[model samples]
Target: MKKLLLDLCSKLEGRGIHEIIDRLKLYYRYLITVLFYKPFIGEMGKKTVIYSPIRFTGLKFIYLGAKVTIFDGARIEVVDRYGNQRFSPCLKIGEGTSINQNCHITCAEEIVIGMNVLITANVTITDIIHPYDDINVPISRQPLITKKVYIGDETCIYQNAVILPGAKIGKHCIIGANSVVNIQVPDYSVVVGNPARIVRQYNQMLQSWEKIYQ
Candidate 1:
């Protein structure tokens, strides 16, 4: 009996037990969202479901809209630029948006996520960039640069994508996996690749996407 129990324990130790515990914890998500998360946020609209075990900070500057669902392991922070509470509305997520697991979003200035946006797992969205121009000062000690990142309504950002500072993604746009977006994306466009470029754009007159080559 002892050997049998030890063997079972050894098998369960290999990721299976951890996954079971995580699944079990999901049942209490609503309770955790209301009791632990709601009060600290800048704004939280109705019926917002946030999966637990999320790493959250600077909640006073973060706003989440109605029916927004944030999955497990998301790290979200609204950092004060100077470590002072001078900035208001650092992050804003619009209604009906779903943010998948393990996404990291840190904002010092402003990050506006518009309505009905879908952000896949492991995406990184940041409005602040570390300054490294000065040779004398360490990069970590240098002052950071802040810009606004705007993701428009109905946009879909795929897994492992990075939305850098000053990116303005328009409505109905699709950002492909592992892409880096640093510029403005037009409405109804499909953007892909590193330093993401618009590969296809919808033509209203033709009612179809026109392939773009450059």
Candidate 2:
């Protein structure tokens, strides 16, 4: 199959056949994805494209809005049960949100990502935290603490950023690469650092992003 594709590509080098082939492949993949996952997903809107090789758990607890694109190698897990505890978890991805490759979203309670949010590669968003308060029990066996996470509309979370439990990122915010956000982020702000802090904020009157002195 590889040899045949290579030979075909060589033969059709300059005839714009490559683009046609690519589109066909994409359409085929989309069809396959919908057929395989649609039955299990609780609510999946039209034209939501989920690429191949995704690790999904509790599909019935996940809701995807229209035109949401989840790239390859993404892991979306909704944990409904942990030991004897049970949760009614919901993971909602709003319309036009694009979650890039290798992104991991784990929700035990609720995680709501608003419309047009851009989550770049390798980002991790989770609403559950593992507690190690007990020395007698293993950390993994301990009860989990969960909080609701919210990423507002038009927010951009860059590569390798971690949105931890109870994070409330406001609309049009920019979460910088490699940042760890665990608290509330005001609207139209640029945050960056280990424990992410606002470095700039959009001045509506001036229509510009001004550096925050603090």
Candidate 3:
């Protein structure tokens, strides 16, 4: 009888030790991704969802419904009001979208991003607006901020582009690399050049973007 009891104790101890090791592996993986790599999201229109690669701290994460994809060494900040103010502040995205390496996405008011969007490396999307009317205050410190930014579905924004506030890119649009979107680009348009101009419109019949020669 005593021998039987001893055997059962040994088996229980082994199982308990194995469970601890498994839990440690999961924790280690989460830590590595949050520290070194970026995370992706599922879907939402309010806040951006970050599945992996979460930062250690200084992450507001207010707008979490949007499907946000983070690449390696990307920095994300979401800041909103505590009480019931004018705006709650959110960065929203639709389903089936992703972002590439080394990007920075920050918002204070509200940003709406549609589904099936592809963002390349070193892209910056911010909702904070800066005022140029005042010469006394620096551009960064001006209080006169603008509205939010919106990116439609099935849109492809290339590398090194900056999408500022109060600018809206419609659905099925392609934004060129190294471009600064200062104004609104209509739906189904191919935008290029600095302060991005609509070079062409997408033809639904061809399933490709057509050039505007005229």
Candidate 4:
């Protein structure tokens, strides 16, 4: 009887029960988003949806455009370091954008995401860098270095990408998975790798993407 019970426990742990719990969590998140969360955001537009288990700080500085959908586990924080309105419009998400699960976007100065942007899971977009200039003070306590990040219209950022301060991603750009973007990417360009580089660009004449050598 003890052996049967142990087997049952192992089987249950390896199967259906875990999946059921996960599904339940997802549904609950969706429900909370629909019923409670969306209304609290400033400048939240029509047909916008935010799945719950999401965290936000400084909602007044954050703006969401129409038809934006934010998936579960997103952290959209507009940090006012000294708890003041010194930084206004810290974050702006344009129309028809969709941000996938576990994405983190923390804006100190400004981070503008333009229309129809698609950001996949585990992406991090930040406009502030923690200062390490003062050795006397801890890095966490030191003043932040703020810069504006602009993600232009129709940009697509894949999973595990990091868009750092001063990143200017132009319209219709594609940022590859696991890439770290810190520079300007031109319109209709495709970038990939640790320090992202433009590997391809859209050729208007051919209406296709042409490879960029070196």
lDDT of 3 by residue, 43-112 (tens): 2232233334334222334323334544556666665542242345666656667777777777777778
Check candidate 3 and list the clashing pairs. Answer: 39-52, 44-65, 47-63, 47-64, 47-65, 47-66, 48-63, 48-64, 66-93
lDDT (Cα, tens digit) per residue for candidate 4, span 28-145: 5545655676666677786676775377788778788888888879898888764333555468999999999999998989899999999999999999888798899888777677
Best by TM-score: 2
lDDT of 3: 0.68
User: Against the true structure, what is every candidate's RMSD?
Assistant: 8.5, 5.2, 9.8, 9.2
Query: Per-model C-alpha lDDT, please?
Result: 0.87, 0.92, 0.68, 0.85
Give model 1's clash tally.
0
lDDT string for model 2 (46-135, tens) is 878888647889999999999888888999989999999899999999999999999999999999999999999999999999999999
Q: What's the true lDDT of residue 121 in model 1?
A: 95
Model 4 alpha-carbon drift over 4 Å, by segment? 1-35, 83-85
TM-score of each: 0.84, 0.91, 0.65, 0.81
Cα lDDT tens digits, model 1, 13-115, are 7567678576445535755777788998888997688985367889888889998999989999777755433555479999999999999998889999999
Which residue segments of model 3 deviate by more than 4 Å?
A: 1-68, 81-87, 204-208
Superposition TM-score, candidate 4 onto the true structure: 0.81
Clash count, one per candidate: 0, 0, 9, 0
Clashing pairs in 2: none
Ranking by lDDT: 2, 1, 4, 3
